[model samples]
Target chain A: MYLLLDQPTISQSSGNVVDGINLEDIKEFAKAFKLRRLGLGLTQTQVGQALSVTEGPAYSQSAICSALASQMLAAQLSSQQQNIFEKLDITPKSAQKIKPVLERWMKEAEERYASGQNHLTDFIGMEPSKKRKRRTSFTPQALELLNAHFERNTHPSGTEITGLAHQLGYEREVIRIWFCNKRQALKNTVRMMSKGMV
Target chain B: MYLLLDQPTISQSSGNVVDGINLEDIKEFAKAFKLRRLGLGLTQTQVGQALSVTEGPAYSQSAICSALASQMLAAQLSSQQQNIFEKLDITPKSAQKIKPVLERWMKEAEERYASGQNHLTDFIGMEPSKKRKRRTSFTPQALELLNAHFERNTHPSGTEITGLAHQLGYEREVIRIWFCNKRQALKNTVRMMSKGMV
Candidate 1:
């Protein structure tokens, strides 16, 4: 995520700001937020669950996911058009709005962690959401078929994903998410390897 | 990293390619490479080690790391300037060079896996490298302190990282890598949550 943060050259050259908020500041805080969260031994799920309890339905895991994920995603964009898309994109806007919320929540979390882990847990105050989608399980054969398709084309059209869902007897949305997640997982594995190399 | 792949709207508008390689094609191959590697039950470390043997001294885990990591990283960039930077950057160039190597290795591994896991092991063909870096370990207190600092600032610049090393009695490089791994770990955790949310 800080890949965008380290871009002093770009930011300095462009001098772009959104709603009087420096993108650089948001980028910096985001990096700090992740570091702070890990230091307290909290996963994003935990933080999301905790925030939901205090911030109401507005701060669910999906909210956290969309917010944080967008920043990380935005950092990876390398083309002018993609950069423009990011500026106008709802995802990055959502991230911008969510930044202050995350910043405050992290500060509170760090303060609690400073006091003690027990206090930190109390601060987290997990209240499980009543509704959670059941875990999707794909058969080995299904995975094999999916992998074959993925090998051939990583980005399948909506119709293609729907076709896959029909063939696999799973929901179309599930198939869509499977591809999204599969891509994210591959990126992460490479990232870990990169860090190891460094 | 197909997050960037699924973006037809953005890609069509920008239409960027590097080194005569369609970004889309590279993205697809990376996803396929990962899925194939997993299906063969080989970890990135195993693949890295295996490649080290065949690619000689020039192709260590770090080489594999830079190559594969850059493609995934390249897929994520949304800005044209950043895209140009990525192409010029050694990281992506290294990644471009290594892509074909990985593709070949994975093909052979898959053939071996189809035969048997036993045969797959033969394909891995481990040869111990004499120049492996010793792993770093941190004291609980050191971790606590480091976390404390990380909470305050994620990007501590070179001097701050150096200062941390002096205070912790570790090499500056080790401290830097720790932060890098820590950041990667946090991103992975959120990505997992995002997938679950979907």
Candidate 2:
């Protein structure tokens, strides 16, 4: 049931609907969001930073990329228009998901402004109390085990990742990300070496 | 001259050429590669693993995705056919770059086989001497400084990354990747938290 719920659906229809959400509605919201944000005198970077300090899900560029790619594929949007549309930085699915979050934030900001709290920081909510999780520190032993596993198989299956996470007493997601970063490191090394050879 | 050489050109011609490399040539090579690997009784996984051990650029999935996405966009391939064609896992640009490397490896493997070296390990060359660089270890103080900077700004410019690397005595590339991984971690945390809320 969980798997069914999580399954990704490829929308083939031309109506621009994905996951039962209207893409047209999302496009409208994206335009309105930009205008509203600008009216509040906030930059996208400022909003992103502020959201990190609040209880909202912080916007990451890759998240936007994934959502946009999937949405663009579904919507059958022209490749030429991709650059212009990217300014919105919110795809149909992500726009639908984040609509309420941004709406609430905008409402709060407006209320604060009306109440004479006009400072940029006052509405952006740079509260230090709501901090993100601290960076995970791997013990030397754990690192050894991880490196050994990586040497054996750079791409581990989900089961292998979960098993290793259990063995090392870390979150499975952390283990998965460790492999991801390790792969990126390996790629970078290969690229640098290739350049040196050139 | 270097900047001009490195600039990415968006192929506007309908001749299926990108960066002066023909897409049709890449498609042909991709098809032949699958057949050649099968003739050697090797799976794609085995080939990927073997390539990593050789003095060749390791094939990271993201590298393939980026190359493939760009190629597909240029080729204007139907989105429906993406999954079917993804098996090749090599774009025109990447195929052009890596073709010689793969061809060399294949030639050596065939030579060894003809000389009666049937062992998979012998041909794969799983030598420990050609190991990838050791994992980078960040000191506790470095971590503190990185975290402090991250709190101030999650996305740093190239100049900022170079400066930070110099200050910490790490490679600029390593610092760049640290920020990338940190952003991934933040995204994963936000995703997990959103799920928990639901």
Candidate 3:
């Protein structure tokens, strides 16, 4: 079931609230997410760049990872080819053993959402990396291309990048870079827009 | 062009830099956005909520608005929905216009971006007012009906709520409430998703 958090004055301790979050947990979650967004070079404003600018109404700095977020927005802004399963939300004890399970998990999530279970809640006790190291150089052009591609693909029938590349008069490799950078860029942008990743 | 903010740390400047942000005019620009988002009852995280969680990344708390200083986050996130007519790095008066100019600015920005300009040099400005209060109330049946209609409408030629409500034996008022509530629910969901809000 989806949650409603309209009341801003969230009680720190009600004693009876189920699955309720506490101030201490809030602080811990906040710190980790903050470090990740910044360490990953994402700012909250940038994360919502695609959503507010491209898809829907604007949101605040928080609300990045809650499964109860916008379904349409998620579908609209996601990196089509970038599997959500690969996101570092859940950890696997062994990559080999968990590969199939991971794939199934993706399928299930997609189906569940499609079947109208908009809010997802299982994370399998996954852990994010303490320090992630992604070393790559990307340009703005690359980001634009990928963003365009993801947006287009979210539609029923996808478009061809070859024609797009030809129109833009750039190399295919450049276009590929654009998609790669675009996904990362979107991720950073999404995170920033969601939680306030400083 | 788009900018790739490098992970490389820039040495803090004792002589000119205002805590990594050059304040001269940016401060006023920041203030304008602060007033805008807050006036709208938006926290920083709420401003960035539309982007990624609109898609479906997991939730994070701290990292959501972590990368942006409150001022900058407020400025950029507040203006994410609107377009900018000036450079973000310019005088606050120039940057402060980002909020009001957003919608028109976004179209222009898209055009300019398509033509060759990948980066927006300025953050947009806006005028926010608590007077522009959003409607967030909905009856449960209305919400259920609207969501049901949404599911149907997702198909190629999905049904509209009016038609669905008729089929579901509900009145037009009920359907309208459902739609209103659904919209708010979606927006609220996005709000929560940003920085993994409530």
Name the candidate that leads on lDDT. 1
Off by over 4 Å in 1: A1-198, B1-14, B81-88, B91-93, B117-119, B130-198
Question: Candidate 2 on B13-128: residue-level lDDT in tens?
Answer: 44655456756554444445556667776655456557766655565544433333333232343333333124333233444665566567776766666676555666674443
Query: Judged by lDDT relative to the true structure, which candidate is superior, 1 or 2?
Result: 1
Which candidate leads in TM-score?
1
lDDT of 2 by residue, A34-148 (tens): 5565555554544664565564434532233233223433344554555523432334555566666656666676666556543455445344544553356676888899876
Cα-based lDDT for every prediction:
0.58, 0.54, 0.35
Between candidates 2 and 3, the TM-score winner: 2
* Ranking of all candidate structures by their TM-score, best first: 1, 2, 3
The number of clashing residue pairs in each candidate reads: 18, 0, 73
Considering only the true interface residues, what is the Cα RMSD of candidate 1 after superposition?
15.7
Q: Model 2 segments beyond 4 Å from truth?
A: A1-104, A108-198, B1-130, B194-198
Candidate 3, B65: how far from true, in Å?
Answer: 18
Give lDDT tens digits, candidate 3, residues A92-193: 222122223223433444455446432222211111323222223334664566444554442112235655544343334445555554334434433333
